[model samples]
Target: MSEVVETTDCTNGTTTTYDVVVEDARIVTPNEVVRGSVAVDDGRIVAVETGEFDADGDTHIDADGRVLMPGLIDLHGDDIEQHLYPRSNAAVDPPMALASADRANISSGITTKFHAIAFEDNPEKDRSPELAMDLVESIRSNDSLLADHRIHARCEITDAPCIDAVEEVLVNDAASLVSVMSHVPGKGQFRNIEKFREYYENDANLSVEEADELIEERISLTEAELSTRIDRIVTAARDSGVVVASHDDETPVEVERLDDRGIDISEYPITLDAAQRARDLGMFTAMGAPNLVRGGSQWGNLATEEAIEEDVADALLADYHPPSLLAAPFVDTGETLSTRVARVTKNPADAVGLTDRGRVKEGARADLILVDPEPTPVVEHALVDGEPVYKAEAPR
Candidate 1:
């Protein structure tokens, strides 16, 4: 583990003041916030102090009395998939889709993102494995996007027939996080018949007749069948050393079973009990950023703010909206802006085992965002590892 180092050398000794100076901004770190000038050299924060200073750099940004903080680390988001297939029946260019997704990501100050691509074995949502593989290749090949994008594969274990697809993604090293999901209608997270009905019948763009058929298919799975598939996927996760997360756990019993399988992350535990169990078991608890932004869960599950208040939630993921990760908590929590920012930045980074980034501290990776805090606090600029990726247009 690389320890964080502090740098305090000033232009008092050398002719060069600093490589890059971000001044006139409110800087938010993990523990505190200060109106300061943050200097960057060799892509690491060198100094953070209040007061203007002469600086020399290939680039400089005047934050204009706005907020400067660590770029958000989004652990789960489906915005990329939405870009690839904007409409239910349409397919966009894979590379273009990724580029568009990255641009959207930066607009919200997310410097690092784990794109959760669902491996849907269901005929309606499953893209061809070849197409999925191509998209992953595009993301890896083109890393000069607005944010650092990694792959998080959502493997529907109940779709046991499609295990080959999951294995292929992992073997190709396209998957960074693996989540086991099951859509069996009668049980598991979607146990509420009305919730399942609303999702497939209306939200999924399926005709009522077609939705009925899909529901029937899901309801056909027996406990024995589901258990067998779960065992197989859990075994695969263990062997690969892939970070395994459980999705939408609703009960303590469900969390206990997930814990027994060596799961380290609990993605959206539906109930307070399940979330509490996850926290006690030392699993990283991830809630949707949208939930916090929207003020409640759309499906009537655990509210993100309530979860945070209870201290059951450890990380906030931008489940669908990338920007919500930047905006939601700021409004929900009464904490100083800096503290709200840490929940999205440092907290998630620490949970996912990416400690090098997240905080705006010396020796940390220069994944930072500078925003004008206007037009609903737009992301005026974005930087990753001291490299500029996006700069918003000047106001009219």
Candidate 2:
């Protein structure tokens, strides 16, 4: 996947003229929120200063005390799949789905979106592993898109063939982010077998008897097979320099084992102890933003609010909702605004080795969002590489 895009009509050294300038905004920096004006030229931030700029810009936006922060970088979101397969078997055209998902993410302030395509062997309607891999390739190759859409290959280690599928994507350079995951019942996110049954009942529309058969099949994978599969996938990810993350960490011991295996991130640790262990080991811990917005996890797991209060969470994933990721920073997590903002921006970017675009510093990529945070958090303007991708209409 390509990270750098062509800069257009950018500012030059001889002339301080900028392509765009945003004035009177509450800028969210790495450590503090300061009122300033930002000048963007040639897809990069050229100036950060207090108040308005004297130089001319192609366009000037009045931020009016609203938050001007780095656009949200969603590290793990399955919402693309939802857009693809809106109903059980009904499917939307891939191009249309991509367009819709891009608009949704851009409108919600997500400048970079990692579409989590599953490599798990799902036998449900329109939920085949083949479809997931196809979607990955499509998202990676599409050029006409708003958000920087990248592929996050979710490799279920329990399925040997799916693990191979993940390795293929890595070797082909189709996925930027790769995670080794296992959603088997009675462990990790599905520790309670009954909850797993309920999930499959709704997700796959399976009867209890069929769900029981699935449980048996999932648990039948030998420990040796699990180790071999995970080693293969993780090694391939490391060899390709792709960021490797572990999903649904269940225990402190599990977190430690994943950390030892060189996982850079822990996505949705099932227990606080697991999340704490990940942070202690210097691995970023990510939780679903929807979990925070909805007050708790849909399934019984670590509450995102508690994770933040405990200082174990480092980033928040949109997971399945773009609006949740946009509003999560303002959801009263009992933290400073700057601190909360980083969870959706700088932290996730740093996790995926995307350091240049996730912060609002001078010389960083001009990917930013302006938002009104009073009655509700709504994106007023969204820019990727200093070009306006989404802008709300002015009030009548």
Q: Whose TM-score is greatest here? A: 2
lDDT by residue (tens digit), candidate 1, 222-325: 86776666676667766676677889998898899888877889999888999999999889899998898888998788999999889887778998898788
Question: Candidate 2 lDDT, tens digit per residue, 296-392?
Answer: 9988799999998899999999998999999999998667899999999999998889989889899999999999987889999998988887889
Give, for candidate 1, the lowest lDDT window spanning 10 residues. Answer: 1-10
Best by lDDT: 2
Q: What is the lDDT of residue 216 in candidate 2?
A: 96
RMSD of 2: 3.9
RMSD of each: 3.9, 3.9
Q: Residue 4 CA error for candidate 1 (Å)?
A: 24
| C-alpha local distance difference test of each model | 0.78, 0.87
TM-score of 2: 0.94
> How far off is model 1, as Cα RMSD?
3.9
Q: After superposition, how far is residue 206 of candidate 1 from its true place, in Å?
A: 3.4
